[model samples]
Target chain A: MDVFLQTLVAGILKGGLYALIGIGMTLIMGVMGIINLAHGQLMMVAMYITYVLHLAGVDPYISLFVAMPALFLLGCLIQRFLLNPLLKVDTILPENQVLMTVGIGMVLTEIIRFIFKSDYKSVSTGYSNATFFLGNISFSIALGISFIIAIAFTVAMFFFLIKTDIGRSIRATAQDKDAAVLMGVNTGRITIITFGLGSGLVAAAGCLLAPVYYVFPDIGGPFTARAFIITILGGLGSTVGAIFGGVTLGLAESFGATYISMDYENIIGMTIFVLVLLFLPGGFKRLTKI
Target chain B: MLKVDAIDVFYGDLQVLWGSSFEVREKEIVVLVGANGAGKSTTLKTISGLLRPKAGTIVFDGVRLDRLPADRIIGHGVVHVPEARRLFREMSVEENMVMGSLAPEARKKRRETLAWVYELFPRMKERRKQAAGTLSGGEQQMCAIGRGLMALPRLLMFDEPSLGLAPILVEDVFNIVKRINKEGVTVLLVEQNVRQTLALCDRAYVLENGSVVLQGTGKELLADPHVKEAYLGL
Candidate 1:
């Protein structure tokens, strides 16, 4: 029983990292109506940045401050130059966008591979293996920190989307770009900023994940797939839904590993995804359509 | 004052506005009445900076607007409330209204304008927390107009504001337009409902095949033989 509870705690902690990555994906996809296959690659790049910073003796946590804004600016530039033209183009066909983003992802991963090979790299902090106890449950300090930071990032994103002037523009543009422009929203600027913010969150996620997972140029593929599942399950563009879906996925994986063979984890996750696709018809239909 | 001078616009190779011209004096409610595909909305769009004129210029308060982008045109106090009540559906009523003030002055006086908007549409205030998608047709129209008001525009243009509205609701909405105009905002209203629009407008322009064929005071245009025979169903 104690071992089962321990696995549960670990799973939930890991779920935090998943939620962090998925939230970034959801924000970009939900607002821009483009499924960024390059998202995972962006995360991988951030992970590499964190890894390099750690290798140079900077703490991974401190590297977040450096990585986020850099990634954000990169995202903004990409949106302003590359994606803004596509805004005039149609996005109803998901395949066209998927192909475009897949190409971008490939280019990004290859660039990183050309510079930093495909070898695994990880950030080793001083408290990498540190833990804390809450009653009978043992919590890894690193995981707890990631979870707290993840929630904080999500909260900040929510406030931005809801409270500030620019945030309102993002939401307005997401709903209807034509209407947003009609309402005097500089959609070009909004798209650039939103893309930057989304990419920045991915950077933060990568930094948090570096200390917990083995990082490499190709590491983002699995995380991206996991994010795809979580975003769909939670309803796309829903910040709160991403966190809940992540925790649920984490618990499921833990239970599947314990009761069944650990090798069946992937199978279990895919099965749930298939079931959701079949049964839900539309995930979170109550959500107001933009 | 606004002047849309002999502007020609096209959708691909097909011409939508051919030498369309009209003028709205300051604080006047000017109505453009036309049949389907007559380019009434297109004229409004051209003047509001959504579509540029291929041949002519839109002059608002003596400043030419052909070079400005749609959002930038709002700085000159020209705002378009598009057809179909294009409120941001996923956001709350308050959020949608807040977005209306995305223009510089609106952003600066956000608090004052927001309170005024809620006062203008009390129903919106009641459902301030509700998602705009859930609002009824009339309520959505109110939100759209309220949003345009938030911009503090000098010239507020409405496109087909009466579309899809009930008869009673249409009267209420037109009354609101008159009220908004009386509040010292110049209004350029585009409508399919010729009779009611003529009833409220200070002056009227009749558009046909993308050009203004008739222009006069509201009563003068209403009394014209062609307008009486074709539009008033008299």
Candidate 2:
């Protein structure tokens, strides 16, 4: 029973960080109606920024202040110069924009590879490996801190979306673009800001994970796949759905790692993803209206 | 207050509107009536800057609007209440209303505008907390109009406001439109219900196959032989 509870606690804590990552991807997906395939690549860039700052004797947590805003600017540039121009392109297949993101992912990965190389760099800090025991269960202090930060950010994000005018404009743009236009929402500017916000959020997740995980150019590929899976498992644009999707994925992966073969961790996630696709096609969005 | 002079619009390769020109004087309720695919909605969209004109110009109160973006057009006090009640489904009705008044000028008067809108559509007030998606069809239409009113438009446009509603509710929506016009807001309405719209409007333009084929006072058009033959089926 203690073993089970230990795994559950581990899953929930990890899930918090996953929710942060998923929220970023989902918000972009919701507002833009296109997947930022470079989402994890952007996170990888943030992680590298944190890593470089760490080399300069800055703690990873402190590096967040730099990494997040840098990534936000980068994301805004991508939207302004790269993605927003596609709106006028009159492409036969709308998927061309999505393909552009995939290309962007490749370019970002290669650029980071050129700069940081393929060597796996560890962001080991004083507290990275520290843990505390609660009865027979143990929790990593870093993971606990990240979980709290993630929850705080998630709560703050909800507040921003609920209470602010810009947030309402974003939601309005996502819901019915024509109505938003009629209401005087500058959707072009909204898209740029939304992309920036999404990048900043994913950057936060990247910084949170940097101390607990290794930084490598290739690390982004797997997390990119995971981000899309979380988006699909949730709903295309549902924030609440992304949270549930992240938690469900984290729990499934944790349980699979503990009981099933360690090699089958991805397979377990894939199986659940397939099941949800088959049975609950719309994901948690259909269940939770918001 | 508004002038659309010989505007030609195309959707990609296909031309949807050809030299469509009309005018809406301040405080007049003008209707654009036509069958499906006749470019009634396209006219509204073009005027609102959703689609740019290939030729001619759209001038509102002496400033050209054809070159502006959709959102910027709204800043000039033109608000469109679109077809099918495109309310934000997940947002509460109140929130949806709140979205209409997001611009700085409109935001300043949000409190008074909201109160006035609530008085105009009491159903919206009663169900302001509910998700807009859950409202009955007519109530959703009223809520959409209420949202448009929240924008404090100098010239308000409605596209197919009575689509997909019961016959009884159709008259109610039309009466609301007339009431709104009576309260001193200029209106540009698009509709397929020729008989009722012609009677309710002060003036109207008849569109057929993307061209403004006819125009006059509502009673004049109602009495025209061509209109009676083609649209009224007299």
Tell me, by DockQ, which candidate is best.
Answer: 1
Q: Pick the candidate with the highest lDDT.
A: 2
Give the 10-residue window scoring lowest on summed lDDT in candidate 1 chain B: B97-106
The residue-by-residue lDDT of candidate 2 on A3-43, one tens digit each, is 79988998899888888889989989988999889999999
Model 2 ranges off by over 4 Å:
none
lDDT of 1 by residue, B188-211 (tens): 999989988998899999999988
Backbone clash pairs for candidate 1 read none
TM-score of each: 0.95, 0.97
lDDT of 2 by residue, B76-152 (tens): 78889988988988799999999989878889999999999999998888999999989999999998999998888
User: Against the true two-chain complex, what DockQ does each candidate achieve?
Assistant: 0.80, 0.79
lDDT of 1 at B178: 91
- What residue runs in model 1 are displaced by over 4 Å at the alpha carbon? A87-97, A285-290
Candidate 1: residue A136 Cα off by (Å): 3.7
